[model samples]
Target: MRMDEQFILRVPPSVAERINRLLSENASSSEDKSLDLEFSEDGRTGTFVIGNDRFPASVLDLPCVVESYKTYDDSALVKTADVGQMILVRESGEASPDVVEYRHGLTPPLRDARKRRFRREPDLNPELVQRDAGDENARNANKKAPPAAAAKPEVPDTGGNAGEPDGSDSDDSDDSM
Candidate 1:
């Protein structure tokens, strides 16, 4: 890799995801969208319509995978940054808006962040754990029958009869009275 040779930062898988997230957060503003983004070869050039702005394919960055025609590498499909959409950049000075390579790759800052995220998972925060446990308890509470309520047996009334009534006992026996 030389200063003049085409070189990009090699990134880990976890770092790549974080970079994408940060980029989304950065681009969330309306003002950010108004700022022109310029990139090259993203399938978006001539492929998308954005209001009155008709951006050509030259303005998008394409996401790329390093697919070597030579099938002899350890990881045959080299992981590479493929620009996806043309980014419209704000004009510098009086110059025209230029397209540049902006990629969704892992940079140092995001790499560290991703590492921290994965590494810190085992150091559980008691508060967060409690909150999650509380939520789970609430969700399951409806399914559990409480012991106090369950202990009371339902007594079925057989109209005061002791399972059977002797037929010799007549109801009209009170007629003599």
Candidate 2:
């Protein structure tokens, strides 16, 4: 990581002294240790390197009280007992191989929306129930219908009684057959 991108951590003086003592002891050990420790110029931040794995200074300073370590397909998740935060480190060559931090594990804080529960009704023209008497179609209809035809008497049905069914029950039966 670039020097500008590195995070400058703030630690207590006693904790810093203890970390410095531990680093010196680890450095003078005859056995080849897997972890390589490095401190920042201000003596506040420390880096712990193990093989290809790298952790933040704040994360490395925590005591060895790990809650869990879950290995995924392309990443590893670490949960520490000191802080209730889940740290996710992705494998190399991945598109976004970065250390991600989560408060709980999965969910994040709620965000604001540009719009919410918005409704819109389409524009519509009113129904034309009444037509103007001076319209061309109205004038043409009045001209097409003569006054004599409009004054003609109404025709009635030939049933035996008004508003009743016909009494005839004639069925289709051929006498020649």
Candidate 3:
């Protein structure tokens, strides 16, 4: 599709309802009402955010333009189009109306990075894996025996006014009052 041309995206009824609700809520709350739609790096999944609420959504058929944008950079805001009204696809005999729109968002670089960083991968680091295995074996070997109690060090006694409750020197002979 041309850059200026608008495209349509099909979302579930729940998503459409959420969009409508967000639109209404934002319209009453602020003059700059906007529906922020962000998609995954793969463009397969997305989410709609308005104010503090977030609604997760999936794209049935992501357009090439969005995919192109995602490929261009780590962070991409593909396009901004006027969100059209929900319409029922009578030809397809679909029970729910689809949300028509041309705008979409991409997962931010930081978000994607964080996701990758936190994702579990046992074989990611062989050294770490080996260390963990060793630790497990050590724990299992020592399971039968209780750990020895550590002895507390005793403080040496110093005969002086160090333990005075006033915590001040008795030689307070100040001549310069």
Candidate 4:
């Protein structure tokens, strides 16, 4: 449904009966017998108020109410005269109850992108990106050095005097001891 369009919400029979009962009960005591339907910020939940008493209400199959209250700048007001049986919600003036079925969730409403606020593009630094790339290149070069060192031929060790740092005669060293 359009943001500015008027829609009708068919009140359940149980709720309508209770409202009528409340209206009749408060007719003698209370001066204001008007039905007030106030929706939560999310529009999924609502309350029906008459005089001093309040009744909790759940909004069923009305995604447009949820979308309008959450996204658009338009505000919804229910006519007190239309409070009996069904509710007529309009931006400004009165509307017929015949337009109720079209506003249901059968056909998804088109959202106006122009009315919605989108996130701005993020700011990036060219210097930081270049520095990160350079650091990665250095790390890759260091990683290559270890493999190259491992590829070198290991020298085979010779037993006895060949393994020793200094060459000496064994019999001569024993005589000195």
- CA RMSD of each candidate after superposition: 21.3, 20.5, 17.7, 19.3
Local error of candidate 1 at residue 93 (angstroms) = 20
TM-scores of all predicted structures: 0.16, 0.18, 0.26, 0.25
lDDT of 2 by residue, 18-124 (tens): 44665667645623235555766854344545434554453322211224443566576754223333222222332332223321222222121112222435554
lDDT of each: 0.43, 0.40, 0.50, 0.51
- Residues 68-118 of candidate 3 have per-residue lDDT tens digits of 222347576664554332211121233322533312223344343423545
Off by over 4 Å in 1: 1-65, 71-126, 142-177
Q: Return the lDDT, model 4, position 110.
A: 30
Q: Return the number of clashes found in candidate 4.
A: 0
User: lDDT tens string, model 4, 117-173?
Assistant: 235456779999899999999988877444444566777866666756784677776
Sorted on lDDT, highest at the top, how do the candidates line up? 4, 3, 1, 2
How does candidate 1 score on lDDT?
Answer: 0.43
List pairs with backbone clashes in candidate 3.
none
Q: Which stretches of candidate 3 lie over 4 Å from their true place?
A: 9-18, 21-33, 62-177
The deviation in Å at residue 110 for candidate 4 is: 22
Model 4, which residues run further than 4 Å from truth?
Answer: 1-4, 12-14, 18-32, 62-177
